[model samples]
Target chain A: MTSPVLTVENLAKRFPTGRSGVFVNAVNGVDLTIAPGETLGMVGESGSGKSTIGRAVLRLTEPTEGKIIFDGRDITKIPEGQMRPLRRDMQMVFQDPWSALNPRMRIGDLIAEPMKLHLGLSKSERENKTVDLANRVHLRPEFLRRHSSDLSGGQLQRVCIARAIATNPKLIVLDEPTSSLDLSVRAEILDLLNEIREQTHAAMLFISHDLGTVKLISDRIVVLYLGSVVESARTDELFSNPAHPYSQSLLSAHLPADPAAKLERHVLKGEIPSPINLPSGCTFRTRCPVAKDFCEHEVPKPHHIGSAEHQANCLRIPDGGNRIAQTETA
Target chain B: MSLLEVENLRTHFISRDIDNQIRVAKALNDVSFRLEAGKVLGFVGETGAGKSLTAQSICGLLRPPARIVGGSVLFDGQDLIEMPQEELNALRGDQIAMVVQNPRTSLDPLTRIGDQLVRIHQAHTGGPVTASRGRALDMMQAVGIPDPANRSNAWPHELSGGMAQRVLIAMALMNNPKLLIADEPTTGLDVTVQAQILDLMKGLTERFGMAMIIITHDLGIVAHYSDEIAVMFAGTIVESGPVREVFAKPDHPYTRSLIASTPEKLQIGGGAKLGGQPPDLYNLPSGCPLRTRCTFAEDVCATPPTRKQIGGGHYSVCHFSGALPEGGGPQ
Candidate 1:
């Protein structure tokens, strides 16, 4: 097996709320490893710390605990000066392309900026590669001289993708890259990302709240609740037989676009509790349909479900009570 | 008679540019649909497709610069378009309630949630204060807000996204409205919370026999929650029909592309007929608004296409509606 490109062990991030000693626990004890050319999708709702994990892995946001090893390098505590060269091997694509790009910069300059900084290339060489990158992302060469403000949302995102791939980084973290895009445009973006992944062989940490989109691109999947990962498995296995109660409920809640598909809905009651004051033990216990008394005190450890690669953090998995009964409504 | 019938609706944004030239955006053109009591109709489209504009026009919610140039919105046998402002104001919140997107911004920041609910009821029904308060609490309970008595005192800022959405739904239900128009109600909400809210709204509609028009960009929401679906493109409803029939056999090219773009059906690099620019509202094409982006555009597309009925009340506004080639699915 090829060596993993990125490995995160017990990653956690907390932000001070200005009230001394009060902090927002954004990510808590997340462990993941993404092999080269693999796409690991992270799914969660708002405040689930999916975005924080993506940012922390790139060292964009400092993790309060744990370690991030990229390409066998322990640069978690590396200073900015030392991290500059390493930045060439890590890239990130944000959610909103309109805000992610500089409006004043020409699209050609923006895509070429990464190459100019990382690669020792002349201006003409960089310009040629910029045009080549534009063609790869399916952007018309004429759009190169235009500003971001002149382009549509879909076009702006294509520019962002071109910039992210300019460096040919070893790892790329995408945070809901297609959430703001329209449906047809979203499919186009996903297709482009898949093609880039195959060509560049870059390990990707794909973060999104949309399960269907995640299922389309990811080879492996991780489900997060509050800040911790509740389950992680192979894509097909996770969708077919999710062991964690939260994963099951989440899959059940997703409304497929097809009207003919049977809907086995487990409409969970109540809202996700405030992340500031997380629930004791299992963070999802407050809303878990099959939560027990022990779930309030004991933090369930990850138990392998079908294989060593398929694991879930739920106490009920051992007793065969993890599955929530879904009502066949429609 | 249907609870609401909108016929040949047309809304335009007439404004002057810096050069002082009159520029009119044909935002909603010939929009028409009907809803019976206890039924749900979904308006699905991409941005700038005017799904929300149709709702705003039917409810008489258009502001300055945006006027209903031509249309007749009939609610319970009365024309809402011809109705006086004062009369429309009285009927709006009482019989025709609206829930917009952004639950936090829609609510009053300074007022407690319960008081806001009470105020809406009083404004519509002019009931006694005590009676209004009782109705507010009942509404909160109906929307499944936990501990209505305690949570009612909580301010809007204190509520979560899902909670705030529930409060908004409760406010819409305070007067037992006959028609509810929800515009992108669950756009920013979590999937689990979205299911809960959709179930709550669907249950409320059935219980009160209220007709609902749910406008959203998510086709999944329309497929399951709405009985009928209207596929809008460039301010016009390109297709309208029963949800099952439309999904089974979409006649419009744009509708086919949308359905094929879904993750379940999409084939990456398989020539899945996706990607197009939204029509320019200010300078729309002469006939088919989607001609500029349509893959199968022809010279004949320059002329306006007439609506063609494709059995079981399913209709498509395209010249080649029934004769279009098969294979919208990913190759």
Candidate 2:
């Protein structure tokens, strides 16, 4: 197998709650991998540690324990001072474009910041490159002179895209890239992201709560539940035949835009379990409709059901290998 | 008669310039709708489309710089526009209740949840404070707030955003008003929380047999929860009809654009794209507001679109009503 662009093993991150005696494990034992030019859709509800995983992978958050191998090098323990050079190969498009960009910085300076730090381009070269990157992402070149505040949500998001791709990063993490945009603008932004991915062939870790958008863009998907991977499968196969109950329920909640499409909507009873004190047996057992008594008693280990590529952390598959056979036949 | 009738409502704002010249926004230009008891009306529009402003105008909550210069807002048998100050005050909270967006800002950060709930009941019904607390607890329980007693005592900051929203819902339900206008209650909420809140609101509305107006920009939400859907643009109801009918055959160009633009789960490739930002209300183009970005614009589109009924109570505000392009290719 061609070495994965980025591989994370047993990653965990903890944050000290202010004055509170307890600490929050934002990410817990997350293991993920991204192939070159591939899109991995990471989905979960809010506070599900999906974003924490992204931050941990980028070394934005100090992971308590993990092995992070990027481009065949272990960088988990790399000093913060030395990690700046690594940023050229990895960029992140934040969820909130309005707050992410500095208000005082003009669009040109904002896009040029990465180039100046990484490439050390001259004044005129940097200006030309900034304008070139702006046009590449569908942002008006003239808007480069304007401050971040003056731009609309769609425009600001474009500027963000320009900034992320400005350094020609090999991998880009888009965190809820289109949630803040309006409908038309959202479609435009999605189109632009797809276009950029095709043109630059950059690997993407698309993180979002919107399952529909994720399925549209991702080649594969990783479903997270309470800071752990519940299921991972090819996007098309997963959406077509969701093996995990949590994935099925999430798919059901999404109302397809087409009125003719029939969706068997399932309302997951009860809120998501708090990560600080997650339920022991199966993390999703609390809300899983098909959960068995054994599910609530012991933690279910990951098992390959049908194919090695598609696996789920569920115990009901039965022993003697008949579980996979029965499930596939049914 | 319709429970509430808003006829040609027009809200304009004074410019921020030193001249203080009247910069007419026309936030709700001739926008009209009614809320029958036990029915839900959903408003879908892009930001700055004036759906929220229309809701505010209905409840007499539009603040300075925004004044309703035209139209009559009739509530039940009385005209709310011409209502006496004392009568309007009584009607504001008791008869018509509004759940404002961003519960955090609307909620009092320093006050306990129970205290705020009691205050709402007190202000509206002037009930006994002790009884109000009990009622507040019951309200919280009804809205699916777990551990109502302790949660009631908790400050707004102590609760998560979702919990704060439930508290807001409890306070809104305190008065048991005939009409409830929720203005984008789930804008910043997680999908799960959004679903839960909507479910709670639907259950409460059903139990009380109350009418509700849900103003939102999410097309999927309106498609699922609303009985009737209203597509608002530049402060006007561009399209309004039964949700099923409108979703099946959207007549207006703007409505078609919206239905086309919304993303679908099944679509693998590029979906519908409407170019350009919505027009500025203050400096709107002379004719159809959407003409600047519309693909089917003509010289006649320079004239304002007219409302045409397309059978089964479906109305479309488009100059070329009959020949607008049909939305296709996966939502």
Badly placed stretches (over 4 Å) of model 2 are A18-21, A258-263, A290-293, A319-330, B19-22, B109-112, B126-138, B146-155, B265-272, B328-331
**Once superposed on the true structure, which residue ranges of model 1 sit more than 4 Å away at CA?**
B329-331
Candidate 2, residues A203-314: lDDT per residue as tens digits? Answer: 9999999887888789999998888888899987788767777777777767666555664756667677676776778888887777777788888777785767787877
- For residues B66-96, write the lDDT of model 1, one tens digit per residue: 9999979899999999999999999988899
lDDT of 2 at B27: 67
lDDT of each: 0.92, 0.83
Taking the tens digit of each residue's C-alpha lDDT, what string does model 2 give over B1-331?
A: 8887888888888556668655666666888877788899999899989988888888887788898899999888788778777888887767788887788998888899899999878887775798998999999999888889888889988877778888888887888888999999887777766877887888888899889999988888788777899999888898899998898888887787678776663232454466788888878888888888877788998998788888677888888775655654234
Poorest 10 consecutive residues by lDDT, candidate 1 chain A: A267-276
User: Docking category for candidate 2?
Assistant: acceptable
